[model samples]
Target: MSFYLDHAATTPLRPSVVDLLTQSLLTQGNASSVHSFGQKARQVVEQAREDIAAAVHADRNEVIFTSGGTESDNLAIQGLFSSRNPIGGVARPIIVSAATEHHAVLEPIEWLAAKKNAQVHWLKTGSDGRINLEELEELLSSKAEEVALISLMWVNNETGVVQDIPAVAELASRFNVPVHSDAVAALGHIKVDFATSGLAAMSITGHKLGGPVGQGALLVSRKTKLDPIFHGGGHERGMRPGTLDPAGSSALALAVKSAVAELDQSIQLWTDLNLRLVQGVITAVPEVKVVAVDLELGTARVPNIVNFIFPGCAGDSLLFLLDAKGVAVSNGSACTAGVTSASHVLLAMGYSQHDSSACVRISLGHTSTQQDIDAFLAHLPEAHERAKSAGFTV
Candidate 1:
């Protein structure tokens, strides 16, 4: 049987989500229409909104629907930045974020800087992949007024490193600066309470937590103002405009609710699987070095993802070798997978270019089992040796 270990990229939909989606797809009516069928459709959407809000400790109005994580992130970054810097207003054009953030966050920030005259202050993280809060405080202390927003990721998708978003928010509060987080990788993997997170806006996607791929949300606090990127109908609090997807929304809501409810059990299972996978890899390939191994599981890092570097071996070689052996894995972000470059996350975490390019990431999810891990381990030694023989190329 083939092993699937790339959950960080995307996980399979839950059975409940699939059932709800199938049912909703068979129904008809537009949520914006005024007829009885419309009202029924509206009810489905509203209930889904409420369910999603409750799942993340947010108000129903706070949940703004989007296509997926990329859209949510783009909206949060560009929308918040625009609102923070209005025409004829004081220039708060500086954005503070980390370099290790997914392209979803990084690209928008880069666009703002290059096209809109915005400045950026990238936060540095240590070798463990955790952002340095002191550096952030220093940046805020000097340029708080000029800073539009501090956009950070709640978790590193590649390495499973958790960032202290609450602490970052608390520090930004003193300066009255808004903070936005890309919580795409954090929501189901950790206890993410948006109310307690102190963030002005946070991005989450349905697919990451076993929901439909095209559905996601940006939880925006009432205190936060956002300029719409899509300007059409005044839907989603006039922040995001489009026709709503009742089936996708219902499935996403169910997925979020289920993921949150079962988080504790999921963590326990992943912790065991993580240890098993890491230990097995080390035993089979003694030269393998586990990424962020010094960090405590379920606290500093999520237990679902385990990144390892096989010295003298190219990550692409190992990835292909594993795939040929019926094991699927990833070298880095699936968004940038086909592009042959070292992982930006690893480079930001103090890894050299060689080490960054020489790493593989194996992420687990609800479908993961001990047998899956065993199959991966059983195939890994040959893959490792073959990859090493090929040597590092990228």
Candidate 2:
């Protein structure tokens, strides 16, 4: 039997989302149009927005639909930067973020720093993968006037380490700096209440929450100001300009609703599964290192994801071996065109390049079961042995 443990990459879509998407697709009209047909579509889109907002404890008007997490991230970063540092206005050049952020957030910030001359303070994390808040306060205290925005992820994509976004937002509030969080990983897995989060903006995607892959949104606070990244008709408050997809939006809303409704049950199941998986790995391979194991699960870290480093084994080799055994898993790092590299997140957390390259990520979701976990554990010992023989390779 094929066992899929890489749910953090993208969870399987729920049947409800599929049914809603299919039904909505059959109905026609652009959400931006004013005709009767368009009005119907608009109603669907707005209702979806309301459902999603209610799920996240956000205002209905605060949700701005986007293509996905990457686009949402780019919009939040670039839009906020442009608005804060206007053409002929006072310069707020500093961008506060962490080195362990997903490429979606890191790339845009780096682009701004490289092309727009924005200064970036890459916050350091301990070996536990949690950002040093005291260090952030020191930076904000010194350069609060010059900082445009602070972008940090609510949960790390690789290690599932949860950050205190509210604390970060509260800190930024004192200095009047807008804070944006890439909450794509954290949205459905944890209790995410946007109203209580104190964030100026947050990004979330559908695929990670068992919705359509192309659908995602950026929840912008009413008080936050952001210049448009794409110029066109005033869609999504002029921040994201394009005809909105009612079908995708509805599917996303259903996914969000369903995930939230079952959050408690899912968390408990994942917590148990995570414990079993980690324990199995440790028992089978004594050299296995579980990342963020010391953190308090469901608070300091998420329970759905567990990253493991098999000393003397290349992550890619282990990944291939597991796949060969009909167990699907993912590396903790990015894979580009068949080339595997060390995870930046692990590197930022003080892991050596070798250890970073040797880690694999096994993430769970709603569809995951104890049988799937057992299958993975049953096959991992052999995979580990073979991978350890293969050694580390770029």
Candidate 3:
């Protein structure tokens, strides 16, 4: 049997959500139109927004729907950057984030720095993938005026390492600097509270939580200022402009609600499976090095993911070998960035280039089962051994 463990990329959709999506697709109306049909469609979209907002403990007005996580990240980063005021006649263009963030957050910040004249303050992470909270404190204390916004991920997508987002938000707030978190990996894995998080914006996507692709929302605080990235009909309170999608909205809401409702059971199941997988791998391959294995509970890495390194193996080779054995995994954030190079996250955490290149990520989700994990471990030993024999590729 084929074992699929790449849930971080996207998850299997729920049949109920699929049904709602199909029903919404059959409904005839443009959400922006003023006609009766349009009004009906608008109701569906509004209901969805309300449901999703309730799921995340945010006000419905703060939810700005976008195409997906990447778009949400783009809108948050570029929008906030363009809207920041000048400090001493120079634009507040410094964007701060950790190198362990996913490409969705990293690329946009890098783009702003490379082409938009924004300066990026890269926060260094420890070997366990934990960011230096004191460094963030110092940065905000000294450079508050020059900093535009601080973007960070709620969870490291590859390693499942959870960041101290609340701490980050609190520090940035003290400096009057806005904070944006890409909570794509944290929504169902952890209970996310946007209203209480003190964030300027929080990005979330549908596909990550069993909703369809091309559906996401950016939770923008009412007090935050951001320019529109997509200009047109002035949708989403002038934050994101486009024709609102009732089907996607409704489907996303259902998926999120379902995931949230089942969170307790899901977490228990994932934790067991992850511990089994991690312990089994360690026992089977004594050389395996687990990332963030000591992350404390209640505020540590999510259990759905396990990142590890096979000292002398190429991550890509092991990935392909596992695929050949009908078990699938990723090197790290495969969909967001090319896996040809060593992981920037590992490098940022001070892992050697060789170990970084040999790292792989296995992520689980709602549909994962013990049998699927058994299938994974069945091939992991041989894959690791063969990959190590093949040696590293640059």
Candidate 4:
């Protein structure tokens, strides 16, 4: 059997979610229609909203459906930045985010800076893949009034490093700056409650949590002010204006609800698998270095992700060899997989370009099993040997 280790990139839809999607596809009703069919469709959409909200501990009205994570991030960042009415006439609004954020967050911030004259403050993270809270406080304390929003990811996509949401929220609260976390990697693997996080908004995608692709939600607090990116029929409380996909929403909600129900068991399974993988790899390849290995267990990360670097070995060559052995892993984020450039996240963590390019990421999920972990371990040595023979020595 093929071993799929790249769960961070995406996950296969759960069987129940697939069934729900298939069934909902047969229903005929536009969510905005005034007839009985429309009402039924609206009910399904509302029920999905409620399910998603409950899974994330958010109010049903706070969840706005979107195409996926990228769109959600864009809407959250741009919507907030654009809606900022200058308090006391500030020239340019400042946006703060960590240097290790995903491209979905970084690219939008860059655009806002270059085009909209929004100032960008990139927070420096430590070697363990966490933002320096003291530095963040210093920055936030300096000109909090000029800031529009602070966007950070709940978990690092490549390294599985978890951030202290409460700490960041508290910091933002001190200055009354809104915080938006991209929780795509944290949703199913950890307990994420919007009510307690004190974040103004968050981004979550369905495919990352065993739901269907092409669906996601932005959880916006009722008090958070945002300008709608699209203006039309006023769907989603005039925040996002496209015809709602009830089928996709229903599948997403079902998957999220089910995943949340099994969160504890799933986390334990990931912990077991992570330990097995880490121990086995270290034994097989003694020179390999596991990033963030010294971090306290269950404190700095989700149990599903482990990243490592093999000195001098080309990550792409190792990835191909592993693929030939029916083991699917990744050199970096799937979004930037084919690109030959080094990882920006690792660079932000102070790794040299050579080390960053030599790194690989393995992420697990609910479907992972011990057998799959064993299969990966069995294939890794040969893959490393082949890569070494190909002049990619560590």
Candidate 5:
């Protein structure tokens, strides 16, 4: 059987989500319509919205459905920036971010800087893959008025490192600067309570949590204001314009509920599997390092993802070799616009170019089994041998 270790890219759709999607597809009527059939469709949509809101401890109206994580991220950053507005002839067009963020959050902030004259403050991370909280506090403390918002990821998708989002938000709050987090990788893996998080906005996608690929949400707290990204309809608080997909919405809602409900068990299983996989690789290779996890910090990184670097082997080579042996993984974030270059996350955490390119990420999910882990370990030694013989790519 093929072992799929790329849950950070996307997890297999859960059976419950598939069932809801199929049932909703068989029904008819636009949720925007006012007729009986439309009202029924609207009910389904609202129910899904409520479910998602409850999962994040947000208000029903605060959860705005979008196409997926990328769109949700764009809406949060662009919306918050546009809404922040300049005061008394000065522009508050500065976006504060970290180098370790996913492309979804980074791209929008970069776009604003390049085209719209927005200034970006890039935060640095330590070797542990954790950003310096004091750095963030200093930036916000110096000129809180000039800052639009601080966007950071709740977790590093490629490295599986969890950021202390609440701590970040608390610091930002002192300056009255809103914080938006890309929680795509953190949603199902951690206890994410947006209400308690003190965050102005948060983004999450369904596929990462065992729902369909297209559905996602941006949780904007009622206290925060956001300008519309798409301007045709008043739907989703005018933040996003499009006809609602009841099927996708209900499916995603069910997926979030199920994931949150089983989070404790899921974490335990993944923690076990990660330790097993890491130990097996290190025992066999003796020269590889699983970058983020530490004996002191324990599972500070998410339980599913384990990133390791082979000293003399290219990451892409190891990836290909493992794939040939029926194990699937990634050299870095799958959302890197198809580039196989070294991970920016590792580089930000202080790895040199050559060392950064030597990494592979193995992420687990609900469908992963001990047998699947065993099969991967069985193939890893041979794959590492082949990759090492091939040597590093220039």
Candidate 6:
């Protein structure tokens, strides 16, 4: 059997979610139409909106469906920045984001800085992957009004590091700057309540939580102001305009609700699986080091991820070797997997190029089992040996 250990990339759609999608696809009419069929489709979409909102503890009107996380991130960042007041008749919007954010967040902020003359302040993180809150405070104090928005991921996709969102939100609130968090990784793995998070907006994707791909939503607070990124038929309150996919929305809501309901048990199972994986790796390969193992559990991490720095082996080589042995995993983000470049996230965490290139990430999900972990551990040492023989250095 193939061992799939790359939950961070994308999770398998739940069987229940697939059933919901299949049934919803048979329903007739566009959500935008005013006819009876259209009204039925519209009801499905609105019910889904309400379900998702309830799952995240937000109002139904606050959920604006989008294509996926990337679109949501762009809409949140660019929309907020464009809506900001121009400084001295020029748009001098500032964006403060962590150095460890996914490319979806980083690339957009970079575009704002390079093309829109926006100032970008990148918050540094320690080797443990925790953002420096003091640095954030300093930046906010110096440039509060000028700062348009702050984007940070609630969990690091590479290392499963959880950011301090409440603290970040409180800081942004003091300065009246809107905060946007990419909660894609944190959605099913953690309990995320928008009512308590104090964030202006958050991006969540469906595929990350056992739903279909190409569907996501931005949780926009009713009080927060944002301009439309796309202009068309005034769908999603005119913030994101297009024909809504009722099937995708229904699947997303059902998946999210199921995940939320099982979150506590899922967290516990993942924690157990991660502990087993870490311990098994340590016992099977004495030379390999588990990165950031000393950090307190659940304090800095999500329970499902275990990232390791394998000495004397290149990450890609080890990954391929494992693939040859019927196990599949990733060395870095799925979005950037084909590039073969060193991980920027590991580099920002103060790892050397060698260590960064030698890193591998194994993320688990609802379907992970102890037997799967054992199977992976069974193949790991041989994979490491072959990777070393192939002349790929640590």
User: Which structure among the candidates has the greatest lDDT?
Assistant: 2
Output the lDDT of residue 309, model 5: 85
Off by over 4 Å in 2: none
How far is 115's C-alpha from truth in model 6 (Å)? Answer: 1.3
Per-model lDDT: 0.91, 0.92, 0.89, 0.88, 0.88, 0.88
Residue 6 of model 1, lDDT score: 89
Instruction: State, as a TM-score between 0 and 1, how close model 4 is to the true structure.
Output: 0.97
151-252, model 6: which lDDT tens digit per residue? 999988999888989899998899898999999999989889999999999999999889999999999999888888789888887799998889999999
Q: How well does candidate 1 score on lDDT at residue 271?
A: 94
| Candidate 2 lDDT by residue in tens digits, 1-394 | 7999999999999998999999999778887788999999999999999999999999999999998899999999999999999898549998999989999999999999999989998998899988888999999889899999999999998999999999999989998999999999998899999999999999999999899998999999999998888999899888888888999999999998999999999999999998898888899998888998999999999999999998888898999999998999999798789788999999999999999999999999989999999999999988998998888766
Off by over 4 Å in 4: 86-92, 333-337, 391-394
Model 1 over residues 297-342: C-alpha lDDT tens digits? 9999999998999888889898899999888999983335466788
Off by over 4 Å in 5: 86-90, 295-299, 333-339
For each candidate in turn, the TM-score is 0.98, 0.99, 0.97, 0.97, 0.97, 0.97
Candidate 6 Cα outliers beyond 4 Å, as residue runs: 86-88, 333-337
lDDT assessment of candidate 6: 0.88
Count of clashing pairs, candidate 4: 0
lDDT of 5 at 314: 87
The superposed Cα distance between candidate 2 and the true structure at residue 209, in angstroms, equals: 1.0
Q: Cα deviation of 234 in candidate 3 (Å)? A: 1.1
RMSD of each: 1.2, 0.9, 1.7, 1.8, 1.6, 1.6
